[model samples]
Target: MLATYPIAATEQNWISATLLGALRISLETLQEGNAPPEFDEALSEEYREDFLRGPKFKKAYDLFIAKCRPLTVDQRAQVLTALNEQNNFPGVFTSTTPCCSIKDAFPDVHSAANELFKHAFEKLSEWKTPGCEQTIRAKYHQLVDAHLSHGSCPFCGYEPLEAADPDLVDPDLDHYLAVSIYPFAGVNLRNLTVMGDKCNRSYKGAQDILLDEHSARVDCFDPYGAEQVKLSLEGTRILSGPGEGPAWVIHFDPDIKSRNWRRVFKLETRLRANVLERHYKKWIEHFVSYAQRHGFDITSTDGAIDAVARFKETCEFDSYPAIGRLKTCFFELVEAALNDPMTVDRMRNFLVESA
Candidate 1:
């Protein structure tokens, strides 16, 4: 969930044009639905002839326009807060709060506003629509570019792309602000995210993965912003007796923010695979090679663990195989053992014996 580059000029222009077209369509749509009592009293004969002629719908419609206006920045913090407060939109599209639903959130919603949201939500998904996919939704190559750019699944850095072909499109454009929950923002360029095929379909299927901050996860790092953290080993590790396999325990520091981000994509368990383990193992291989050339045992307990930890601080912080994410678990495992010289000696000797 890395931060994304800004929308290209052509893309922004297309989106603005499409939204303007949507506004025109929204006016016509409001003509279909009958005026609710909330604004009926304010309208006279000619004005009453249409749905948006009254203030109820017009107010909401105008607000919708303001929101859809080209969002120059990605965060939309102030705008979204205003939306939840002034617009009465609580982002309840997926509210687990019993009996709450999209329809319920906007019961007295005006037709113009409804149509505006409806148009963007419905049209954005339709490739042939004017501002959706510049060329064709099926052929929109950005999804492909996004997949290749990340080198791995954007959602889970461990999953690498094997090939790219028209018939075999594997990556998916995930709606970071889920379409079901926040329909109004469905087509917003900022809301769309490039994701791994499995992360989009199987692992994160129909579930909300957004934290207070999107693109906040490291593997899953925000490509748009910068961050810093000193990672630590934070879970129980079991020392093995002879013949037992090494135990891997990885849990990031306790923070609601990290948990929410991990929960959204199931990073904890899903990331526990050989793909990431291989990366962790490579670090040792690298140090061994470095030791051989330098005529020193980088793996020796004398200063090995601390040296690795220091190196990790310099190289692994906020990178991938990204740290404080899925791949660093093994390093933590090693760090745990290094804390006990007996365990370190046992493991180091064991590695030599096994080799």
Candidate 2:
């Protein structure tokens, strides 16, 4: 991921309090062998009437009752304990050394719990703030605008992130730890983030980040607090094999976190198709144009090398057009290649021919 955005404290607090309050009340009522209350009285006194009367709330309550009521007394106690632990979501999330697995956390809990949590997320729009009158979803985007003003998807750093407005389309809210497989984290603000459509639906759909296909535990970047991951093309080389174009032999770091991130998002394939292959020629052309505009003698080898180095220095990782890191690395590779007189002559010839 390219960046991290702040969670809206007001929205997070309101939704979590209301939902957790309702769930606790319903579970406690069921523990006493009674059917949970309908709507107004289901949640705590502080949050009952304002946010829990809607159809979405009713549906979520119904799902919980159907799933949890049938559990044995001991089972209900275990689930309640899990929910209590989940209340400390921030600690559980940040202290996760490698990653958290739902199976390990709730080993003996009923699988139906997953469905209940899923239902709550699906109806997230129903839980409105008390006086603000905006759904949690709507308020989240307003927070996004404030924090993530870069206007690019943090996941891929290539696509434009749409502004969330009532009149405009909202960006896709991705559950970083996918809600379907991970229970009790579906509604946590720390677990949710706005991702590009391609990264969310196309590449990372339902894929478990905690465990690989072989079920081995792996570390992944925390979407909320991860450092900006760097990409480098220093050791990458062009292959001499026959194909549509020069086949890139890209080498990535062997660290577990980097490997897991690359595998989960298919980053190599995407970086090649979306950034390297699609933009290399244009980048070179732009370099030549920049050199000409800056009064560089591109026909000379030393001047061409200087132009490449200066252009590379201008690339910023979080710049407007996106893919700045990759562009910088690509130019570094170009600058290195310029050390070869043959490559320099090719660049000079291309500059003249294109002119």
Best by TM-score: 2
lDDT of 1: 0.45
- Candidate 1 per-residue lDDT, tens place, 18-128, comes to 443444343333333432222333334332334343454456556654443433223233333323322221222222322112433333222334455555443333434
lDDT leader: 2
Per-residue alpha-carbon lDDT of candidate 2 for residues 1-355, written as tens digits (9 for 90 to 100):
5677774533455555667677788888889988887756766677666555567656656766677666788878777776665445444444344333435544434355565566666555666666767777788778876777778887676777788678887888887766666666667777778888888889888887666768776656666664656567766653223343445645554455667767878888887888889887777778878899998887777887888788888876435434677778777766766787656665456555544
lDDT to native, each model: 0.45, 0.68
- The whole-model C-alpha lDDT of candidate 2 against the native structure comes to 0.68
Residue pair clashes in candidate 1:
1-220, 2-221, 2-223, 3-222, 3-223, 3-224, 217-220, 218-221, 319-322
Off by over 4 Å in 2: 9-11, 25-42, 81-119, 122-127, 238-254, 317-322, 339-355
Candidate 2 residue pairs in backbone clash: none
TM-score of 1: 0.54
lDDT, residue 235, candidate 2: 62
